[model samples]
Target: MHELAITQSIVEAVTQRLPDAQVTRVCLVIGKLSGVSVPSVEFCFGPTTEGTALAGAELQVEQTGGRVRCRHCGDEFPCDDLLAVCACGSVELEVIAGQELLIRSVEVRNHV
Candidate 1:
């Protein structure tokens, strides 16, 4: 699954940035429309992070709902999917949220 590759990238990025840090947790923000599977990412996290600074780190995730702004009617509303139509019968929706894949935080311990 692509989540394996994504997980690898996350580990690599974190370790590269904080080579000396003792990482205890990694907080992620995955959007509902991001096309990334949370379960698959969880499965890959351990394997991808093995031997890295992120090894043994907890993977904490926060999910966001999809929101769109109707281009034709200027209406802001919640959208569940790409094909969602606005109440104004407009298909011209500009995605304002819920397409994010972010690393919000990395909790680490100070060197003793």
Candidate 2:
């Protein structure tokens, strides 16, 4: 699965940002439309983080619903599906969020 690659990337990025620190936890903001599976990420995290600073790090995920802004009426609403349509019967919808895969924070212990 691509989650392996994604997890590896996460570990690399976090370690690069906090070099010499041991990562204790990782908080991620995942959106409904992000197309990334939480279970898959969780499954791949340990293996991907092996032998790295992120080893044994706990993953905390915060899932967000899909939010879209209607271009025709400038209305913002939560969409359950990716139909790209607004409730006002407009096909012009701009995704304001819900496709995000962001690292909110990282808890790390400083190296001696």
Candidate 3:
């Protein structure tokens, strides 16, 4: 699954950032509309980090809801899914947030 690949990439990036550090936790910001499977990422984390500095590291995922601003009525509201629209029956909308997949931060201990 792509989660494996994504997890591997995340591990690599974090390891490169902290070459001699022992990773403790990775905090990720996942948008609800981003289509990323949180469970799959968690499943792949252990395997991808095995034998690496990030071994035994914890994965923390923060999910954000979808939001859109209506162009017609200038109203902002939360959307249940990726379909960006407003209740005012307006198809034109500008997304304010919730379409992001970002690595927010990492907690690590320096190797002694």
- Report the number of the highest-lDDT candidate: 1
Kindly list the per-residue Cα lDDT of model 1 for residues 1-112, writing each as its tens digit.
Answer: 8999888888888988988998999999999889999999999998888888888999998988999999999999887688888888989999999999989999998776
lDDT of 2 by residue, 16-89 (tens): 89888889999999898888998999899888888998999999999899988898999998875787677779
TM-score per candidate? 0.93, 0.87, 0.86
Q: What is the lDDT of residue 57 in candidate 3?
A: 92
Worst 10 residues of 1 by lDDT: 46-55
lDDT of each model, Cα atoms only?
A: 0.90, 0.88, 0.87
Runs off by more than 4 Å, candidate 1: none
Residue pair clashes in candidate 3: none
Measure candidate 2: CA RMSD.
1.8
State how far residue 45 of model 2 sits from its true place (Å). Answer: 0.6
Q: Sort every candidate by lDDT, greatest first.
A: 1, 2, 3
In candidate 3, where is summed lDDT lowest over 10 consecutive residues?
79-88
Q: After superposition, how far is residue 30 of candidate 1 from its true place, in Å?
A: 0.9
Q: Could you give me the TM-score of model 3 versus the true structure?
A: 0.86
